[model samples]
Target: MAGLQRELTLRFLAEPADVNFGGKVHGGAVMKWIDLAGYACAAAWSGKYCITAYAGGIRFVQPIHVGNIVEVSAKVIYTGRSSMHLGVDVKAGDPKESTRSLTTHCVLVMVAVDSNGKPTEIPEWVPTSEIDIEMRDSAIRLMDMRKKIGAEMEAHIHP
Candidate 1:
């Protein structure tokens, strides 16, 4: 069997259609791109259809202007019985500039599914490098944090 792919990177040029009334790339548009990149990375790793089960800690640190070069990178940091935890980072800068600042960062959980849309088991991923091991550990830590946050949210009554 071929080794599982753990990372994917996608680049796009920000256009007028992606901008908001503030004249910067819209948050919704960036989110859509994030999901697409995460899905692509998960599907390729699992060799099956995948869906976004959860996306958390999405933070737009800086604005991306129209005409900037945007790069979305997704890396599979951890895996479970049927899910993969991905760390996605979005960065953008002017084409003529040499530096790109981080625009957004998020963690996405993607689950593999079968034809009927039921979750299916995927090949187990083992960390082969020091960086991969550290990433996996970080994913585990984040998972714990997510559970705690979710519990807190569930306890709060909504209007």
Candidate 2:
């Protein structure tokens, strides 16, 4: 299905309300945007309602100022029977300037669900280009790392 339309981008102007006391956009606002973009990508790819199962590795690289042109891009880099893993990037730049710097990045896992809210099978995404392959591989590496971390956490919590 031609990579299954695996990417989605959302762009808008950062509002004054998005800023914190320090006058920069709050981290929580950016996270909300990431979730929104991730949900859109997952739903488009799966053709079903999706819910986030995991969101981690959120890194805030820089602060975003209000009135900046903000862009959040979400791409489905890997998929399983019911889960789509997305890499989301957030960037912002002065409206008068052409350059945009990355402000945040994270990986999210979203699961497609049926009317009963149970996980359901969805279409798979296949990498088609070199960049796509690289992105997919990166997502797989992150997945492996997450599993290791989860095991460690379980051990620490129970033992």
What lDDT does each candidate get?
A: 0.92, 0.93
Residue pairs of candidate 1 with colliding backbone atoms: none
Model 2 lDDT per residue over 1-159, tens place: 323678889999999999998999999999999999999999989999999999999999999999999999999999999999999999999989999999999999999999999999998788889998998999899989999999999988999
Candidate 1 global lDDT: 0.92
Lowest-sum lDDT 10-residue window in model 1: 1-10
For candidate 1, the per-residue lDDT at 55 reads: 94
Q: Give the TM-score of each candidate.
A: 0.91, 0.94
**Candidate 1 at residue 65, lDDT?**
95
lDDT of 2 at 52: 98
Q: Which stretches of candidate 1 lie over 4 Å from their true place?
A: 1-3, 157-159
Candidate 2, residue 75: the lDDT equals: 92
Question: Candidate 1 at 136: error in angstroms?
Answer: 1.0
